[model samples]
Target: MLVSEVMLQQTPVTRVLPIWQEWMDRWPTPAALAAEPAGEAVRAWGRLGYPRRALRLYAAAAAITADHDGVVPDSFDGLLTLPGVGTYTAAAVAAFAYGRRATVVDTNIRRVQARVISGSALPAPTLSAAEMRLAAALLPEEGAQSAKWNAAVMELGALVCTARAPKCGNCPIRSECAWLAAGQPAPSYVAKGQPWAGTDRQVRGAVMGVLRATRMPIQRELFFAPVPELGDDGLDGTTFSESLRSQLRRLHSLMAPESQLERAIEGLLQDGLAQSREGGLLLPD
Candidate 1:
């Protein structure tokens, strides 16, 4: 439950399932993961978007092994003390894994709650105190009921009450939906999606990809190869092969700008995702 919860944060289950399964097969216990270097966890993370979560999970495993006697903490507060574990994750684990009566408000639950009770097109940009209070209040009195309600509400949001193209006709609670009652107004404010193209995140991801692809330290110069301009290379658009075009496109991404690559490498080093070795860089050990 903890692994799935951590992996599922802003990431789809389809992307997470195989990685989670492989992770479980490799390190079935806290002790097993704790015994390995943190870098192994990052390598295993394998393009999961946010790589820092891998380090946090590794740290949590080590803490669990050393402090919790190699067992996952059942209590919400105890779980929160683990690295990378937050209020949502702690509450989720308590309610789902241990059958505790937790409020358990995930993204899905928040959306469901907003449409069903608050008559809103979407949740607030951030979770508000009132929303948290409402979630707690709506939780069922009994532990088992609370757990089931959590799953049902979350599923309803993920499937039928999606952010875009909500299947209102298929929603089980459409009859009582406050959003539907209010005539399905537009969201007061749509959150801007994070940009990826040509951004530092893309450059950083590319750097991480390079590091993850090799065991040996890569020379700094390797990341600074700027893509050659087609005309400058004496190749016009019509002369370039599809395979070469693909390679150039990939090269353009790998070598963003020398400054961007430098920033990415520095950020990765500072984040402890990569280490500066003998005049080169590699994943931390």
Candidate 2:
């Protein structure tokens, strides 16, 4: 449950499924995972996007093995103490894994809550105290029933009451949906997709990609990948052949500025995702 929750965060299920199965097969128990080096977890993360979650999971495993006798915590508070666990994750683990009643709100549940109770097209960008109180109050009194309620509401939002192109006719609570009664007003704020192309995240991921491909320390220049010094006779682009220009563009696309590369490596070192090794860089051991 912990692994699935962590893997599912901001990642599509199709992308997470196989890697998750591999992880479970490799480390069925917290102690089993804890026995491996932290770098192994990052190596096995395999394009899950946020590799930090891998390190956090590794840390969480070590914590569980050391502090909880190698068992995943059963209580919401106990789960919250895990390295990457937050309020929603804690409540989700308690409710879904242990069948304990909790205010298990996530994006889907929040969306459902907004449309059903608040008569809004969407929930706020961040979770609010009012949303928390409402979710808590809406939970069923019985633990098992509340757990089911959480799953049902979240699934409804995911499948039928989706943020875009909701299947209103299929929604079980369509008649009671406040947003429907209010004539399905548009969201007050515009939704935006996260930027990705050429961002620091791309540079960082590219650097990590190279590091993940090998166990050996990587020379820093590989990331900076500076173009060979154009000498005094430096042929300008206009003087170069078409093929040369094409190759130059391809090479340029693979390189980052020295400053950005340094910043990325420094940030990785600070995050414990990387370490200096023999005058080069490598993932943490």
Candidate 3:
């Protein structure tokens, strides 16, 4: 439950399914993962977007193995002390895993609360104090029932009361929904989309991809080399280095400007997902 909660954060269930299954298959227990190099965990993360989560999970596993005898802590406060476990994650693990009555207010749950109780299209960007209080108040006094309710409300938001194109007709609480009662209004604030094509995240993924694909460290220049422009006539099929050209072209599509690439690499290093060695880059050791 702890691993699933961590992986499900900002990541879709479809993408996480196979990876999570493989991960559990490989490391069925915290002690198993704790015994492996942290780099292996990052390598196994396999394009989940946030590679730092892998490092944090590795750290958490080690902590659990060393400090808690390989058992995930059942209490929210104790889970919060683990690396990468925040308020939502701690509450989620406590409620979902241990059947503790915790206020597990994830984005989905917050959205449901906003529309159903507050007559809003969306909740505030950050979890507000008032929202926290409301979530706590909504939780059932019984631990098991509160856990079940938490899962149900979150699933409702994800499936029926989605942020965009909500299936209000299919919503079980449509009749009593505050937003529906108030004549459903659009959100006052616009939600910004994360830039990808030309952003640092794309470049970071490219860099990590190269690192993960190769066994030895690759030179910085080759990793960030600019794509050579091809004329409208296109490449000659008779060229001797056609395969090499194709590889470079593919690499070029992934490459960002030198400065952006360097910044992205530095960020990865700071996040402990990548390492800089002698003039080359590699995954963390």
Candidate 4:
């Protein structure tokens, strides 16, 4: 479950379920996953957004095999000591796997808690120590049932009290919800997101899609082929340079004009996907 939770980071659970099952089927235990090549894991990742989580999971599995005898740690501190494990993962494993009374808060749990308990329409951007303490307070008294309670709250938040359009009338906790009691206060902050269409992220996803789907890197021209459509919707000849600038241009042309395409490219470089050498853009091995 820890492995699935980490893999599901920034991803919808519905999308991660099949991939998670496939991974566990292929590598039933930590020792089995540890023996496989990290590249194989990344290949199996299949467009789950942040690809590095695949690598991190590989590393964590190997670490567990080497240091912990292939067992997922039972303690929150022990889980936290593992690679890629954080507060949420640690608490989640403790609560769900070990049946500890730890407070487990994800986006769903957080939003539900904020709206139902805190009387806020939305949660703070990030979890705080005080918020954790508050979540701990809401845990059912029985340690054995704590995990079920946590899961129930999170499920309620995800299915009924969703961010965009909450169905308060159908909510199981609607009667006790603080926000509903307060007449459904308006959200305080603006919903923020980079538009998907014609954005650098879209181009990057396209580029990564092309690269990951194939065994080898493709030529620069293959990506920057001319498009009949004008504006950011189409790739133009000017973006076909074999240089880094052209690589950036191809992504920029696809992205919204306001997007930070250059910075996103730099992030890819830092992650070792695209490299600049001999005045040409190339994918890393």
TM-score of each predicted structure versus truth: 0.90, 0.90, 0.90, 0.78
Clashes of each: 0, 0, 0, 4
TM-score of 2: 0.90
Cα lDDT tens digits for candidate 2, 136-160: 9999999999999999998998899
Model 2 Cα displacement at 125 (Å)?
Answer: 1.0
What is the per-residue lDDT of model 1 for residues 26-49, given as tens digits with 9 covering 90 to 100?
999999999998889999999887
lDDT of 4 by residue, 151-238 (tens): 8988888899999899998998789999999999998887786698765567666565545554443445445544333233223343
User: Residue 14 deviation, candidate 4, in Å?
Assistant: 1.8
Clashing pairs in 2: none
lDDT of 3 at 181: 92
Worst 10-residue lDDT window, candidate 3: 231-240
Local error of candidate 1 at residue 155 (angstroms): 0.9
Residue pairs clashing, model 1:
none
Lowest summed lDDT across 10 adjacent residues in model 2 is found at 230-239
Q: In model 3, what is the error at residue 274, expressed in angstroms?
A: 0.9
- Tell me the tens digit of each residue's lDDT in model 3 across 136-239: 99988999999999999999999999988999998899999999999899897998877778888887877777676654555676656556443222233322
Off by over 4 Å in 4: 197-200, 217-266, 272-285
Native RMSD of candidate 3 (Å): 4.8
